[model samples]
Target chain A: MIKVQNLRKVFRVHKKPPGLSASLKSLFRRDWIEKVAVEGADFTVEEGEIVGLIGANGAGKTTLVKMLSGIIHPSAGEARVLGYNPWEKHDAFRRQISLIMGQKAQLWWDLPGADCFQLLREIYQIPQQQFDHQLNRLTQLLNVGEELNIQIRRLSLGERMKMELIAALLHSPRVVYLDEPTIGLDITTQKAVRDFLLSYRKEESPAMILTSHYMEDIERLCERIIIIREGELIYDGSLRKVIEQYAPYKRLTLHLQNQTLDESSKEIFSKMGEKVQIQSDQVSIQVPRKNVTEVAAELLRKFKIHDLSIDEPEISDTIEILMGGKDLRQE
Target chain B: MFVNLAVQLVVLWALWTAVFAESGKELVGEWDLTGILSYGVMVFLTGRVVRGGDLQMAVASEIYDGSLSRYLLYPLNYGVTKYAQQLGNVFPNILQSIVMAACILPFMGSSSSVDLHVTGLLMCMPSLILAHLLFYIMGLLPQLVAFWADNVWSLSVLMRFITMLLGGATIPLSLFPEWSQGALAILPFRYLFEFPTLVILGKVSVNDWLTGLLTCAVWCVVMSLLVIPVWRRGNLRYTGVGI
Candidate 1:
């Protein structure tokens, strides 16, 4: 379990102007600015719960993860993972958790992946039998048994990522913090990684906090979603609630019978909510969730329709709306 | 790497050979050309075996580039891990030194008036390892300055030159003024090279050997203790903010 209250990280960065003259001047007198990377994030996650942390660039997802994992101390407030202060870096606390950052590699580049895994085993003091069993299962699930023997640098990025997962999970940590685990991987490889995490969680039920920009990764794996923007927590709830609260309109597609939309029809469709697309024989419109029935009846009476369909708003679109400064709170 | 080493060897050989050749043994007190040449060979050989400049840079780059997060995340001591990695580099250098000494030692003879006292040489082993610890700490001290500076490459280079001069690698300690040698003895650098060389040559009395060992132990403890505070302060400012 993880609990964070008012967790914040403020970075003091040096400011410098461009050009040689400014650079020379900065040598004697430099400016310093405090940039808040993560601001007042408060959340609690229970066992076997997978939470998706979504945010734009500089949204503080990585900063929050770093604080919880004890890689860096927070500027203010407190956080506890499994009732232990992460920044204290107690040896017992470290043994129970694992952090996998996508851009930064944990494996030894010059050595084989197997070597790093062995080193991890020693560091965590895992029992040999458990280490071998977990290693065997994780490798088979990721289909990377053969790749582990090769030097890590020689493997493709996707392959290396798979090995990184195995390395992080070999000790069967009780809690895992994953930062963009599927980043830079091909679609198929991305799917494979998602499947591996899902299956691993089913068996181990580790408390996981996954931060990613990929909407599919969130929709497919995380039931509880936390959205942050500009270093502030904006929304926290189920994925379905996010769609219901932020995206209040359903997409309506209409196929006109042997006729294109004339000027009068275009004017009528625009009244519904927003026109998504217009074509020779088909037109798409967005309709508010409450007025769906009334709008459908009106459109049916005015237009000679062939077929019509209504679709729930997409999670991606809902995320966009949430990030677009919509007041989408559903407590 | 060998080409660079050969060039450096030639330069050092020329410099010392010139000093002795022109001064006609006056420049090297109580030492002839053979003695100076013998000391020069030992200096270069010692450098080959027990270098710390590269180790410092390695640590600095890791700290600057954020790869140190790997150690911070794990339950291992970063200092001990780095020291172990550095210690691994010494074995191959020891092998090279052995091979080179086998080929070169016989030709120098007693003209150098240098004695390879078997007992003293045996006693120097522990002191040599202690010296390695001292240099390892010395290498790491300036690197922790990376918490404030962007690059410590120049600092490392400067530290190397100072160690080479004061540690008796560039010139034997006997060539310096007696007072200067006394001051150098109070510092840790002389233990890194000159004291070990003296211990090996049986120049130090038994009482002096015990005292020298105690001094090396004290420096080792002091430097090791210094790392704790430096590392703590460095970590406070680290942030680990970069990608």
Candidate 2:
């Protein structure tokens, strides 16, 4: 339900110099710089799909979300969310979409969370029955029923974030932009939030774009992933495809009872894999995916192996290598 | 709050009383010593009723910090929402101002110049409401520039001084020269305080009240229209940082 084509945003910012003299001089003759926050971003999200937008810090992930949610206008290109240009900010389109920022608390600090929801109810003009049903179901899903009456500022960060989610979903928006929704939460709370999102996505079937630094969140929630780097979309495809394409090697950790640390055996292990590290009783190596089992069997037969493990490399490390301009594909 | 208001009223009474004595005249323009005293009381109460808090700071800081992001996503008019927030801040002061006015009116009401009529007060409410809106937009327009500029706090501070002088919060507008009064009557500032003060004093004819209300209403429309473009252009400049 979202289509974007070369969507771009450029910000004109004034440049100033340091020192008292330069500061005074800048008042008379100022310099200007145009910053491209989002450069020619191209992607589309379909209904009932969750797209994980992955990037490091300052990668314009939030900027793209802001433009799509109609919080800010794009400097160029076109975007249509739910068949309406988001920049035009049609009320009908706004009612159909929600943007949740983890770093920002959108509810009133002094008011109870329920009061904030009531205010949103009036703003969106949701029918009374729908509002009540949604509120009950969302609060139940998030397990924040008793916390709703407490002032938002008094609640813990995790509790407050749950209230924020309920506030965003009360109108049952057709599109959702979750920007670091699990940020700053404990592991248990993060899992709770991710699980709640999974349930909500299943029931509501809204097109979702989740931007987060946490790799576990992406691995759990998204099948299709888009990677952004320095305001440009670098990779966009199925999560498994990207992993398989970028990381074609698996790691082997072996423990042997009679393995020797001699140079002759080290040379043999090196020929079979990459980055071979050998110990008196253990050895670890990076082996190509197809050769892992063969290498493990060879080591077992040759050295009285006690244990072995074959595992994929961490996807986050592979992404970091990709972002650093390294070739991840061996072929 | 009550004690502070009481002390400020005493100070205003002393300053105006001394000015009348130093002038060696029983009357100065349309306001006698007792009349200016009543004006002081009105000013004391109306100032709170008008400038309830630092509205410009509230608007500017929210924009600068990107708190405006969430509101922009909502299916509601942002301007009306902000205006409602400003009104909410001032609503308590309105109640206090009424109570304070009732207490001080007993002392100021014994003079011939002190005229309190239900008709006058009824007429004054609409003008006061219009003036409140006009002044609110005045403050809000400058702060919307925060979307571009780094800071706009000084603009609101400057507006306060200009309103105090032109709107006649410190001195009665009747004291201005006739030529200046004619122009000031048409300006939006006079309607903010001077026109409402005149209406409360039962000094204006029905025609004058209607004309004043119409002028204030027109300025409200003109300024509210101006907000649309300024807000539109500024919203594009907003980066929604810090969120």
Candidate 3:
């Protein structure tokens, strides 16, 4: 449903120092800086797939989404959404695509969501029956049937976001670009949104690219993930593989019944794992994933332990490591 | 806003009355005090229709805050959608103009010169709508500068002032010296403001009506065509950020 090759965008922005003097000086000689927003990005998404785009702020995630949605033209490279060049913005291409932004609303703020949907119905030239059916289905799924009559600005952010989703999907677009759909939503609302997208995928199966920083949003919604950092795609694969590769160590923590630990016990744990820390009543160790079980068994047999736990590194921590220029994959 | 306009009319009525009295002339620039006062009332009425606040900050703010992404994604022309949204503001303002003309036109001038032309009034409707379109595009052209500049408020204000003066909303174009009137007449401003008022007041002959409509229509076509290129180039640089 989507094909992108060497998709690049360079933004030429004026650079100026702050103050009235710099403002006046810029009148004659302004400095220009070219920042590569997306650097030779290459990826494709298939029908019925939800690909999560992961990046910290200013990491070009949104830029990639924008270029694919045809909202902004790329300075270089090519992208075809649903077999049409997205940047060309053909009318048929636009009709088949939808962009739902969590921070910005697609519906008119002063008007009711229902009224905005009516306008969208006309804009897309949807059949009356299809428009009515989709409106009913989406509003019912989002459970915003009652709130549709109220002015959009009067609703809460979560409610407004639900309305935005309905608006974007009113015509059953074939390709969807969702940028930070769960950014400001509450936990319950986020879950609701994620669940809705899951069900929607089951029903419509449109190729989707969801860009978000929320780990849960990515974990619960996207099976495949692409990690972007510094305007480049560093990793793209299954989330489990990412966790297995980037997070190679398992954290073994033990709560001890004894207030003191012997030197021999410390030496034994130090031999088993790196970064072993022995406190008064507890010991925590970062052990290799393959040997975590053996180390834990040894510790349990030797120590008078009150509690024991083993946890793999979090996906967020792994992403942070990648973003900070450490590549555990090399090892 | 209505109250502010009302206050300005009262103050201008007294000021113009004094000006004609002090000058000790029956007509200033070929318009008697009563004619100028009637023109002032028409200015307010036409101003309501042509200068509806709906289009004022909408395009500029969207360009700045990246709210335009909503429009960009939809399968619709942004310019047409913007104009359709402003139509809601126009209908009410048009009704208000009619009500004010009916209630206040007689009081502005009791002279026979305030003659209402039934045919001219009917003919003004299409041209009035054309003027509204022309004004909308002109105002929007400068606001699109926000694609590069941070704010276009100063340009918007400057456009408002220039339109008010040259369109005869602030001062009648007849009052301008004869040499400048030729250039002023060639501009689209007068067709937007004063032409409709002149048509209703029976000051326009059939030939003038045809000329005014043609000028307004031609300007609308030219300016509407101008928006396509400007919007296309501007979209090339649009970052679609901030939202």
Candidate 4:
């Protein structure tokens, strides 16, 4: 279980100007700037729950994960993972949690993955029987049998990421923080990773926090999504609920047979919603969420329609709009 | 590796031989030419064994490259892990140094006359281990500055020169002036090389060895205590970038 109450982190970084004189001046006197990486974020994750943390770059997603995993201390507020304050870094707490950063590697580069696993075994003091059982199951699930003996640096990026996941989960942590776990992987490898994570959740039922730039990953893997913008939690709810709250419109693509270039029909379509596009035989229009079926039926009865299709707005576009402050609800 | 070590020994022999010939001196205080040659051999071998391992840059690199985050996420202590890695590198070099010493002793003009001093070596084992730890901490302390500064290579280069001058690496402590020796006696550098070499050669009395051991213990404690706050502050400043 994870409980965070107004967690915050502020980093004071030195600012330097260009030119040799400014660089020399910085050695004695320097300008400082305060960067608020995470600002008063609050969320709770239940056991067996996987929540997607969505944000633009520098929106404090990684900062929040770092704080929750005890990699860095928070500037204010508190976070508890599995009944322990992660910043305190208690051995008992650390043994029950894991953090995986997609850009960072936890494996030893010169050594085989097996050796790294053995080292982890010693560090976590895992019993031989349990270690073997977990290793066997994970390797079998990820299909990384022959690759484990190869030196990590010699392996491909996807294979190395698989090995990283194995290393992070060897201890069977109860709380997992995954920051872009599927980054830089090919589609096939990404699918394998996603399936493996879904199956892992089924088996282990661990509380998980996932952050990824890929919308498909969040849509497929996370039932609940939290959106953060400018270091503040903008939205926190189910994915479908986000669509309803932020994007309350649907798009209609219609194929016209005999209805040609007509200004009156164009005005009617525009009255329904915005005219997305108009071609020789096809026309697309945006409709309010409630009037989608009614508008489609009206078009079907009035015009010589060859085909009609309706689609919901994309999650990516909705998030982009939300992040730009155009569609966010007022406080 | 062996070739490098051999070449280093030859260079050291040539340098010291030139110094002795130019100065027109056969003895330094109580040590004769042969004794000084033996001391030079001991210092070379001991210094190689202590400083040859590759973990000297461990802390600075981990800080700069963001690998320290891997250790922070675990329950393990970074210092202990690095110490273990450095120790693992040290034992084999110690064995090799002993072998090399045995092979070179006959050619140094002592003709196997120098005592191996097995009992004294056994007595010095604790002091040597403590000395190794002291050197490790001292080497690592300056590197912790990497967390604040962008480059600490100069600190490492500077440390090598300081250790060479004060640690009795290139020259024996007794060869220095009496007052300089008295001043160096209060410093930690001499114990890293001079004390261990003296103990190995059976040159020190039992009381003196005991005193050296106690002094090593005190320095180890002091250095170990000093590393705590430095490491704590360094960890706070670490951003774990480029990981």
Candidate 5:
């Protein structure tokens, strides 16, 4: 369980201009600007709930997680994970929760994942039997049994992420904070990670707060979604509700029998929908949920329809809209 | 520490033997086989006790990686953890220094003046321990600069070089000018190496010993107070960049 009240994190960043002269000037008189990374963000997560913290880049998702996990203190407000003040970092608090950042690894790079796992086992003070059981279960779930013995640096990104998950989960902490857990993984590996989280959630019922740009990760593993923008919480509710609120229009694609729809006909359909676009033999339109049946009937009667399909806007598109058209393109 | 000392000892022996052969059987000063071997022990111990690489690396890394937030979150004192790590590093460095001394011992005979008084040796232990602590803290203070500065490599290098020079790891402080010696005497650097070496060599007066020990204590306190405020303010300004 987690509770956050008006969480705020402000960062003072040094500002310097380019060029040798500016650099030299900065050496004598440095300048700094205060930026709010997370501002008055508030949310609560119940035990056993897997909540996705979604945002565009610079949305303060990681900042929020860091505060909750005791990695960094908040600038103001309060956060408690499992009734423990995170920033206080009591040993008991740390023992009850784990934070895993995908981009930044906790593994010993040159050593085998096994060695890192052993070291963590000692650090977490897990019993030998329990450690073995957890390791076996995690490795099997992540399908990384064969890769554990090899040095972490030798493993692929996906393999390394799998081991990272195992290392973080070995202690079986009740609260898991995962930041971009599935980033950079291939589809299959992403699915594997998703499935592992799903199963782990079902078994342990640990409270999980996952932050990622990948909508598929949220869709597969998180029923609840928290959307933040520019350090403020914009949306917090069911994932489906978030989709409905931001992207209410349903997309309908009608495949025609080699017939090009005229402008007037496209306009006719457009009159019944929000956006209408016609290609060589297909007509794609975004219609409101209430007008879908009417729009479909109109299209069926007006066009030489061969095949038809309807799709709700993707969660990714909904999130993009929620963030006010901020770019989510991964580099 | 043992491995490192062994390597240093082997290198010292080879260098000393080459120097001896080049000198045509004539040894330097009263530092014959015995004094030369004692010098090796002194150098090795000074080098080990003045070790700053680990502390520098740890601080630099935590600053660079933004993992220092992890340390800041803990309830335990950061100073304690830093000292613990420095203590851990001392084991290996001391072991290595001893091995280096052993290698030189075979080439140099035992010295008649190499006497260890029980009280002096006992006092020397705590003094050296305090000196090592002071050196570690002094080395660490520069690393805290990494929080504000982009990179600490130059600063760390400068600190190491100063420690080697002023701490008398490479040259004895006694060889310096009286004014310079007096300045070094009050500084923590001299306490890190020169004080302990003098104590071991039975060259320290009781009053000088007390002054050196008090100087080291004052430095430890001063550095801690100075660095903690800087570290706290730096953390406030910390962006946790590149996360």
Candidate 6:
């Protein structure tokens, strides 16, 4: 369980102009800029609930997670995880939670993952039986059977990430914060990671707060999604509700048996959708959800259909809209 | 430890032989073969006790990798952990220094015209340990600067060099000018090397020993006080960047 109230984090950064002269001048007279990284953000995650924290880059998602995990103290306000003040950093509090970052690793570089796991076992003071059981289960689930004995540096990114997940979860934490857990992984590996997370959540019933740019991960793992923008919470509710609120259009792609349609027929379909682009034998159209059925019926009656598919607008698009079309910052 | 010591002893023998051959004597000043042996032992011990490299590396790496935040979160005191780690290093250092001394003692032989009082030598051991602790603390103060400074390695190395020179690790404090000697005597650096060596050599009076011990005590207290405030301020300034 986690509770956060009016949390804020401001970073003071030195500003300097380019060139040798400016660099020299900065030594004597420097400018300081205060940027609000996380501004008065608030959220609560109940026990055993899997929540997806959705945001574009610089949405303060990681900042909020850091505060909850006790990695950094909040500039203001209060955050409590599992009834313990996170910033206080009590061992008991640490024992109950784990923070896993996809870009950064906790595994020993030159040493094998198994050795690192053993070191963590001692550090966490895990019971021998529990450590062995968890290690076996997690390695099996992540499908990193033989990779455990190999040095971490020799493993691929996906394998290393799996090991990182295992290292973080070896203690069987009650609360887990996963920041972009599936980032940079291939589709199959991403799906495997998602499946593992889902299964782990089900079995352990830990409160998990996940942040990932990939919508598929959220779709598969989280029923609840919280969208943040510019250090503020913009949307907090069900995933379906977020999609319905921001993106009301369905993406329709039609494959036609005839490569070319008459100019007038193309014009008619153009009137039915906002953006229509024809490529090769496929005609792609963005149509409002309400008009999808009617539009498809009209197209079926008018043209020779070969293959057709309908898809909802990506969650990334909804997030971009929520953030006012700002570019997403990559970690 | 033994391996490292044997290597150092070989280097020391080569250095002393060169100095003696060039000078056309067995020694220089009051330093005979025995005194030179003591000097070599002290040098080896000082170098061994200088655990500043590891401490600086640990601090810089933690700060650079953003794992320093992990320290802030834990209930354990950072200062206590540092002290404990330094203490752990001392064991290997002492063992190595003894091995090096043993290797050099054979070369000097029993014919050397010098005597070591067992009681005084025993007393000097604790003094040497305290001196090492003082040096370590002094070294540690600069390491905390890594929280703010970009290049802590060069800064730490510069500081360590200055401390070694001023602390009489390179040469005896007696060889310096009277005013410089007086200044060094009051500073923590002299207490770290010169005073401990003098005590072991039986060259220090009871009053001088007490004064040196008191000076070291005051420095320890002052440095201990200074460290916390600096650390707290530094932690506030830490952005926990690259986490």
Top DockQ prediction, candidate number = 2
- Candidates in order, TM-scores: namely 0.95, 0.95, 0.92, 0.94, 0.83, 0.84
When 1 and 2 are scored with TM-score, the better candidate is: 1
With a 3 Å backbone cut-off (N, CA, C), the pairs that clash in candidate 4 are none
Off by over 4 Å in 4: A258-272, A288-302, A327-331, B111-115
Computed on C-alpha atoms, the DockQ of candidate 1 is 0.59
Tens digit per residue, CA lDDT, model 2, B1-243: 689877867887788779788998777776777777777777666667766653758778888888988888999988889888888898888899888888877776455665778897788788778878888887788888788778787877887788889998878887888889887776888878877877887878999899888988899999989988999998877888831
Number of the candidate with higher DockQ, 4 or 5: 4
Q: Rank the candidates by DockQ, best first.
A: 2, 1, 3, 4, 6, 5
The residue-level lDDT of candidate 6 at A190 comes to 97
B31-63 per-residue lDDT for model 5 (tens digits) = 454555565667566556656335767877787
Per-residue alpha-carbon lDDT of candidate 6 for residues A1-331, written as tens digits (9 for 90 to 100) = 8888999988767899999999999889989998787888778899889899987787788888888887777789988899999876788988888888887776779889999899778768899999999999999999898999999999999999999999989999999999999999999999999999989988999999999988888889998988778777777788877677668688888999975878997898789897898887889899999999999998888888898898888877876677675332330
> What's the DockQ for every one of the candidates?
0.59, 0.69, 0.58, 0.55, 0.29, 0.36
On DockQ, who's better, 2 or 3? 2
lDDT of 3 at A238: 92
Q: Name the best candidate (by TM-score).
A: 1
Q: Tens digits of per-residue lDDT for model 1 on A211-279?
A: 998999999999999998878899989988888766878999989899766788788888886856897
Order of models, best TM-score first? 1, 2, 4, 3, 6, 5
Candidate 1 off by > 4 Å: A327-331, B1-18, B24-27
Candidate 4 lDDT, tens digit per residue, B1-243?
A: 579667867787687678768878775466666676788778777776667564667789888888888898888888888888888889888898889888987776752324556886797678678888888888888899998988998988899789877999877887788788778998999988888887877787889999998998898889889988998877777777721
| C-alpha RMSD over true interface residues, each candidate | 1.6, 1.6, 1.8, 2.1, 3.3, 2.8
- Candidate 3 docks at the CAPRI level of medium
Angstrom error at residue B22, model 5:
20
- The CAPRI quality class of candidate 5 comes to acceptable
* CA lDDT of every candidate: 0.84, 0.86, 0.86, 0.85, 0.79, 0.79
